[model samples]
Target: SGDLRIEMRDLAVFGEESERAARAVFAAGKQDEYWDYHNALFEGGEHRPKSQLDDDSLVSLGEDLGLDPMQFKQDMNSTEAHEQFDTVASEGQSIGVSSTPAFIIGGKPLLGAQPTQQFTDAVDEALARAES
Candidate 1:
């Protein structure tokens, strides 16, 4: 994976609850535990239904990740986190993304949950372009 650099952009296409959870995850990044919280959110399965990601669940996930509960709560509700989420969400929209799990690989849009081979092909194509 050394040849690949992945960046996550949180999009709030789901709704307000989803937006809040997304912001909380970004706030967790401030504590250097983004991936930990991220993994915890999806720990039980490959995909979690939106109904299972309420505000209380989000905070609990943070605490389970050993992030300071009070600090995490404050950060999750902070203006900074809201703004950061907004910025990324807007950027995703500007690029014509209108759904969850949309990916822009090598400046090409790959929408939805794709097969593993599709990802490998995209990465290989991108690598070739980079080398050229």
Candidate 2:
């Protein structure tokens, strides 16, 4: 239903490595394993260093996940993936989303690490707006 709408955007706010990591996720998406790849990157920990998301590690992770290494590499460097990531990054920057864990609810921007109740309140606010 229209209860909620969630969208994932790639904004390379962390640095070059962050951009590469986002591209890797986009590449995995081509193989229908975006979340799998994304989760694996974060599996080590939430504060996974940029080295962990390097190109070699990303390709290796794809191999571990049974994705064809060659195809994964190609998709990871593909123009389409690059453009998709670049577009989202630019759009997000334009909208002042220059950090991780950003959210836009009911046309209001919420940034940084938020508590559970904050999200609940955002949702309630959104629902209330819809009703009015």
Regions of candidate 1 where Cα sits further than 4 Å from its true position: 46-52
Each candidate structure's TM-score, on Cα atoms with residue i matched to residue i, is 0.83, 0.91
**Total backbone clashes of candidate 1, pairs 3 or more residues apart or in separate chains:** 0
lDDT of each residue in 1-132, candidate 2, tens digit only: 779989887677788888888898889888999889888877866846877778788899989998889999999999998899889988887777878889988777799989999999999989998999
Which 10-residue window of candidate 1 scores lowest in summed lDDT?
Answer: 45-54
Model 2 superposed RMSD (Cα): 1.5
Model 2: residues >4 Å from true position, as ranges? none
Residue 111 displacement (Å), model 2: 0.6
Show the colliding residue pairs in model 1: none
How accurate locally is residue 114 in candidate 2, as Cα lDDT from 0 to 100? 94
Model 1 compared with the native: what TM-score? 0.83
Per-residue error for 123 in candidate 2, Å, reads: 1.3
